[model samples]
Target chain A: MDDRLVTAGLHEPGLAVHVEDLTVSYHSKPVLWDIDFDIPPGVMAAIVGPNGAGKSTLIKSILDLVRPTAGHVTIHGLPYRDQRRKVGYVPQRSSVDWDFPTTALDVVTMGLYGQLGWLRRPGRKDKDRARAALARVGMEDYADRQISQLSGGQQQRVFIARALVQEADVYFLDEPMAGVDATTERTIVKILHGLRDAGKTVIVVHHDLQTVRTYFDWLVMLNVRVIAQGPVAETYTAENLRRAYGGQIALLDSAATLTPVD
Target chain B: MLDILSDFTLQNVMIGATLLGIISGVLGTFAVLRKQSLLGDTLSHAALPGICIGFLVAGTRSLPFILTGALLAGAAAALVVVFLTRTTRLKTDASLGIALSVFFALGIVLLTMIQNQGNAAQGGLDSFLFGQAAAILRSDLYVMGAITLTAVALVTGLWKEFKLISFDPSYARTLGLPVLALEVLLTTMIALAVVVGLQMVGVILMAAMIIAPAVAARQWTNKLGVMAALSALFGVVSGLVGSVISASATGLSTGPLIVLAASVIVVTSLVFAPETGLLPTALRVRRDKFSLKSRLVLGTIYRLAAEHGDPAYPAEQAMIDAFHRTDTSAVLSRLEQRGLVRSTAHHPEPTPHWVLTPKGLEQAQTPLDQSGETQ
Candidate 1:
């Protein structure tokens, strides 16, 4: 696994996530086969892929939400199970029922549940922290509102706030900008960048090729397996994209448009 | 009713039924909202064989022994449903159906064998199938109270965990919650609830006690805590009403009566509850549609008047109909009532001409402005 990480060109000492020989199969069909990658610490990375490209499966596998058929995931040189407190996840907005009878503040406070452990309820301190996270996402005013009453953007922001309150070293966001408004996308991007600036790693499973360069500094282009990965400047080229998207050059064209002209 | 209440056995039946109602209502909220009501049905049916096994083991009619057997059987049935859904290609509905039928069939066979044994203790074993609330004893009340208190305490203690798991199990798992354990624990809780309800509502009707109140409560509130509380209240009320009604008539048993009472609450809540009730929601939709049509008509006229540089330019009825693609006379009349639009007789032709009032113009454009800003 160390050799695989080195061969993948990751020579960094502080790594946020190290996934090696990760192969996940669903009902005998392999979704992610021998997926290997090591993301350096404190970098905003995007797991870019087309639809049904195992982007979500990869994140779930890393978090041990889905057991892998083979291989293991590590966070900062330790297994994910041992380092769960150091990790946070923002699942896709559609992953949960929005009409669930919970307020925005209640949803945000769920981040602290991992720390609070079983049977102990969240206290005033946890609530204040949740409030701060909500304020960070510009959703403090919506804390008391039922989650279903919030708009799509506000709901997405609330989800981000929930992840924010975890105060983990590595944040994994699955399709954070999938169906949000432009303002929400910008706000989320700013929050991600803020996490990176604060010396935390933010790994996002992103689909919008147009925002990849703008929102992410590191890149993991995957389609069933790792097609190419490294700094966005060197690896986000047309060739790597063509290999990842296969027969979808229109996506490449839009991606190229997002690249700033020097 | 007074005479029946004075009887100690009937009094015990009432207390036991009410406690059953309370527990079922509390846990049923989770079952209903989580789309696991089918599991409740499966578990209740599955408790039958457990009752026979308990009778066979104890060689006597012991409330604790029989209910313990029922709880175990119900939990095993729930586990089987979970196992089939998770480990096989079978879906939840199919698994639930399979478990419910198989366990119920096994229970019936065992019950018949027990009946054929000619044991006096087994005379009322069949009562657990359809419930004989009149057979409830003081000891049964103690079991019901203990189970109810335990369920309430567990629910209160693990409130957040249960809520999170119900809403999003995957996310809860990601947060390092024992999702599987929590789920199994919840299944056990439901089984316990079903066990306590068996003597009052019967296995056949116990599922209703675990479903109807929660569903009825869902119609009344959108908050989980409030929903659970209201469900408990509904369950208690149904229990009391069913018990009193059954006591009044020698022909009636408390099980079906309790179910009927709960079903009535569900029906009443579905039809008339303030927020998500069918009537209010339908009315809101109708009102919104009417207002939307009125705004569209007013906007069309305002646009026409703007084009012609006159606030009072009467919009042609033909144009309004074409724009709305529906009858606009009713909306125009409604608008007239609100002083947003009025019929103008400035034209010589008999065609009704409608013009937007200043208030109507503002009203039409207000929503448009808000929609624009929102988009």
Candidate 2:
């Protein structure tokens, strides 16, 4: 496998996520086509795109949640399956049934299931780690609260805490800011910044383009294909936004006013 | 009751029913949580054809052969639902409904064919439709017992994995768990649950055995472990009570009786369970309204006293009522009982008036912002 990755020139040591010729289709309807991008290690990145631009599909394809039709994704020079332990994921809040019978702490403890392996229950120490993760996300007080009883922002915080418990090297979050309160958005951004400062990769599927420049230093502008990818200062220009949003004049009019960082 | 317990046939019926209850209750928790409650109905109905096929193949109503056939048919029905939902535009309920009626029709056709075979040994074959608890044999207990043990053990060992998948399958896959395999295993477990109850509960009523206990249990707790345990307990109780009632009566079908018992538990839980019950919720709402009204009345009285520059000023009941646009007599009486207010006859008027006691003044003086902290 190492030889195959090396032969294909897919092994890039400094890139956190390496996608080469990735394409995905759902029943012959292409969602992502010939998408290629690389996010450098230790940078807080944003995958910005319009609705149906396959921002989620890109993240899911990289995580191997959705099988790509062609091409591959390597995380830190290894395939996702091999590097599963090093990756953390926060799927969309709508992806799960919130009314499920469980506590906040129990949901956070699920992150340890991957490490605990099969047929092994979570122990006291695992719960303590889960508690600590909850504390990091400011949800320690809600540890014993039922998930359905929490507010949208609190639920989003719980999800982040779950990923935090994974202690992974690369974190992929899908629209972590969608429908969340301002305070939760700040908390999530600060947490991502902390992860990046510790030399871990944090990639978020962000919707609010206004905060894209302020929150993320690395940007991958995608509309079914890679429009631009690099430092936010270089790639978050009005031209790239226009190309990505394409003919959605209402959104582009606002995008046209954003002054890209020098 | 003691005589019923001592009866040999009754003993076997009770034991078999109890075993069936335990497995169905445990596995049904997962089925209901996964929103596959109707899948139980589908699989149980689909098992009918398998029982008939087993009778034809063995030329006798052998319990093991019939149960094995039922298990296969139930599993096939599940696959059909999965295939239809995945390949076609049919939704899960639509596919489940289609599989259920189609397989049940085939089962009915086969059952009629078996009746026409003119075999004397097929006397009790029709009992699989609406179960006869008296037909439970001592040897059948071993089969039900084994299935119960296996299902319980699997649930205990794979508790977290099963929970994670039921709550979120995509997330489970991201964690490297064998999500698809676990799903298949869970579906098979539900099939086993249906198979175990085929003799005492029959195919038609077995779906209730799998769903009713779980539904009742959910109303009692928000924790999965507690819910599953309570569900199993409810199932066992319904089984024992249904079997006993049927054994004591003439021509009472144990299957329908057991289903009725489970339905009773469901209704009881929905109305009377402490946390999620309708009665408690309604009572709580009433309590909240009472407190809120009391606070408003106290605040109004306090304001009236302050405006009059007399701390002991009494507000007339009619005046207070006119301000709030509702009669405050009940609220004022409760407040008076709690020593927060007292009724006194005002001077120069025969009308009774309410005055806040010192305790009431202290409580009323507490800022509105602080009062909302209780909830």
Candidate 3:
């Protein structure tokens, strides 16, 4: 990874994702306001907040899926558009129609579409790579299964496999664990951990507060604005949770029991 | 059949209808999967205004001019729908409905004005309302053929891109696939299909031509490529058969007949297609119930034998029925057929009794945790 970064001849040791003064609104109603944060390379980070905290909006704005009213986002010291091939995104599972007539393998192959560019279909090698990714997520037997027929956990794995095939340096996942089973949740966390160990950064919009301390090493607590952002040990405190979740301090109090103070 | 084939008018009408079917079938798959079936209806109705504009401009009933106008009108209608949905709080259905009614009313006003002018060239212009297959000329076939071939080529070349957009547009955009441009291009292709079909199925029935074949094809396959191909085949069959039937009949219109043929295919596919169809699913449910009942009956007999401390203890039929609160006679017979149980007469008892066989006893000893399986 270091060699590739050096070969690209860009700046040295830049943040995996950097956002400055980002604001987003729908019809003049602000969802996120003047947000600023940076996620360094090779860490599994969680974006934790209550519902309607603009967690999804933050990810979308960073990935350039949604236009920001102010500020900009960069990946590896470059604008999102210029570094798109180096980034992979896993949107919420509910974002797609499960009943679409396609196999699991075909869905995973979509991750390669950006790199493949326009008008080039997935070939045998691309399919083999997709199959390998599916195997990594323990979905090799379900490669030919229709997506609609898969269980929710299996479907989540398929989405992860699709992201895995992207081979991107940074991965953004939106609510990957929502509504999935316990086994799938563990599998997804392990896979994200594996990527972080391999020197790839993973930023997830996570909802499970109880598992944050156990699952992630870095944390960004947000509530339409950045409450705190840093390593979990430094930031996952009772005070930060209260500030981020305002009026839901009771829920945070229970979750804070799992937090270990340094 | 030979005489029908030899007739040039019939031949031209059939060929034109076939071409129309192929294009609609191919393009409708995307529209239907995307849940934009109403978009086809709106576009077809909007084409009426285009037809009127074309007739007004050309001052003659030229197929190319009229179709080109229809295509443009349809595209405009699609844009209107998009604009309404994007700019205002109005939902997609409301936007489509508004576009359909407004554009169609405009078309009717233009059609009436043209009629009031007493132009002889406008003699057959009203045929676009409900298509007249017999009016198709060889030259019109050339135009339809070109449009059909072009649509097929575009779909073939951009199959993956189109499929991605149809299933998940946001994800497609994140992949940097130019989702907006692909959507516009796809909508234009559907409009082109509606235009090609306007003369044969008319504006009103053209939506059916697009939707019915694709809906039927979806029931038969779980792959998009197969569904599209099968949809095209179904469309072609409907076209050919409808044209022939209408040609043979005195008062039958080709448009309605084609729609009817396509509807028949849809109904058949919905009821009879394997795996996903209603009939097979219902049958499977019934078979599963019977197996479950049989297993329960066998288990009852085995439990009765075990409780009595006799491997061949005969459980009375009345006792089993009382325990289950339903007639176990039918289930007992099925179990007997499977050699899991046997009906016997216990000594000093007037009523018949049932006993489990060795195999049935063994089956009952296993846990009942498995679904849809007895042992």
DockQ of each: 0.64, 0.86, 0.78
**Candidate 2 similarity to native, TM-score:** 0.97
Residue B212 alpha-carbon offset, candidate 2, angstroms: 0.9
The TM-scores, one per candidate, come to 0.88, 0.97, 0.96
Among these predicted structures, which one has the highest DockQ?
Answer: 2
Per-model C-alpha lDDT, please? 0.88, 0.91, 0.91
Q: Each candidate's root-mean-square deviation in Å?
A: 4.9, 2.0, 2.5
Please report how far candidate 3 places residue B361 from its true position, in Å: 2.7
Task: Give the runs in model 1 whose Cα sits over 4 Å from its true position.
Answer: A1-13, A247-262, B118-120, B292-375
Candidate 2 CA-lDDT value = 0.91
Q: After TM-score superposition, what is the CA distance of residue B238 in candidate 3 from its true location, in Å?
A: 1.1
Docking category of candidate 1: medium
Candidate 1 or 3, higher DockQ?
A: 3
The CA lDDT at A112 in model 1 is 87
Give the Å shift of residue B1 in candidate 2: 2.7
lDDT of 2 by residue, B1-375 (tens): 688789999889889888988999999999999999999999999999999998888988787889899999999999999999988889999999999999999999998888998888788887888787888888888888998999999999999999999998988888999999999999999999888888888899999999999999999999999999999999999999899999889789898999999999999999999988999999988988888899999999999999999778999999999999999899999999989899998889899899989988988999877866244
**A113-176: candidate 3 lDDT, tens digit per residue:** 8888677899999999999999999999999999999999999999999989999999999999
- Candidate 3 per-residue C-alpha lDDT over B254-291 given as tens digits, one digit per residue, 9 for 90 to 100: 99999999999999999999978999999889988888
